[model samples]
Target: MTMTMTMTRSLTGAMAAELTSLRDRVLDAAVVCVDRGGLGRISLEDVAAQASVARATIYRHFPGGRDQLIREAVDREVGRFWRDLAVSVRHLDGIEARLVAGLVEARARLEGHALLQRLLRQEPGDIVSVLAESGPAVYEVLATYLEDLLSIERLRDGVDRREAAEYLARLVVSHISVPGGWDLGDEPAVRRLVRRQFLAGVIDGIEPDR
Candidate 1:
């Protein structure tokens, strides 16, 4: 290739790598901000400082500004959540077991998440939009697992697995959004209750029990 073409290819590769690193840094910074002060108080300066980048760098990656960055951060976290859940549910047998396990895992993970716990404890309502947008993705993951379990007749015959998964996903999302005052004393108990209640609902919906 010509000298100009070679230089152009080299610059393009460098730019791509830098952009990827910048995106990862931005996401990490967002997690730190939410952990430290919740979403409402997460300043762009704080994110930049946490990421060790100039404030302008954040704008370059996410041009919609702070709100946009926050949304991206939330979306990234949600994506991680779904990936984790998918892995956890693999190889589990019964629909009810998978359902309960998934719900419990999701609740514990989300509620116990350092950043999310801080946000829920402090700002409370600020993360709702992000959480809401992520709900459908969670629902799909749950549905796939439920279908696997139900197909094997491990769950009740008439269960609307899709609806059930969506309901539990919403329930968990809503529960975490509420400000529980950081009295994590009830976290374990609440998780147990959620598991029990969710499993019971599924069992009851199966057949003669409903």
Candidate 2:
């Protein structure tokens, strides 16, 4: 009985891991398909073919089939975007450096994604809805991530960590999507943006540089 129970637990864990793997692969394939041809043009069959899995297998992993696959694909990409953004700035020395690098990285990723650009151009509502759905959760993540500011000396006087984080998160999202003057691709321009606009509001020291 004991041996049987142990084997059963092992099998269960293995099955769970396999399912997670399948989900990840399917999500990746769906994103590729969406990028190649907008959401309206792709179906579960296309995703399955891209993933090298059967339609039935996709359905087994995603019970709602195409709809669930598409939605989860969008969510997964959003999560990936944030994770990539975090990793891009992790090795930097200071908050300002990290912030500037993060801005450039984020703009590149956001603008470089073909699916998102296509959606924005042709099916604006779909992408907007996904962003709106993910916004609050992402804000919480950003707020928690920015808690590092509490220990830093440059944080502006009388600013709470949460408030500062929220402010910065909002600004980053908006500016990345619609950066008016600053060239996010240029390091100096992004550095000036960090010092002039972002850090100026949240950090005490201000250096006038152009």
- Write one digit per residue (lDDT tens) for candidate 2, span 1-210: 999999999999999999899889999999888888887777988899999999999988799987787878877778888998898888987778778888899999888987688799987877688678878888888777776743564676787777887877887888788879878999988888888877777777767466
Q: Give per-model TM-scores.
A: 0.65, 0.85
> Candidate 1, residues 1-210: lDDT per residue as tens digits?
699999999999999998888898888988888777777778889999999999988888888888888877887888888678768977776655555466556656766777666666666677766677766776676566555554555444566866666666565555544435322235455545554555556554442222
* Candidate 1 C-alpha error for residue 130, in Å: 3.3
State the C-alpha lDDT per candidate: 0.68, 0.82
**Clash number for every model?**
0, 0
Model 2 worst lDDT run, 10 consecutive residues: 147-156
In candidate 2, list every pair of residues with a backbone clash.
none
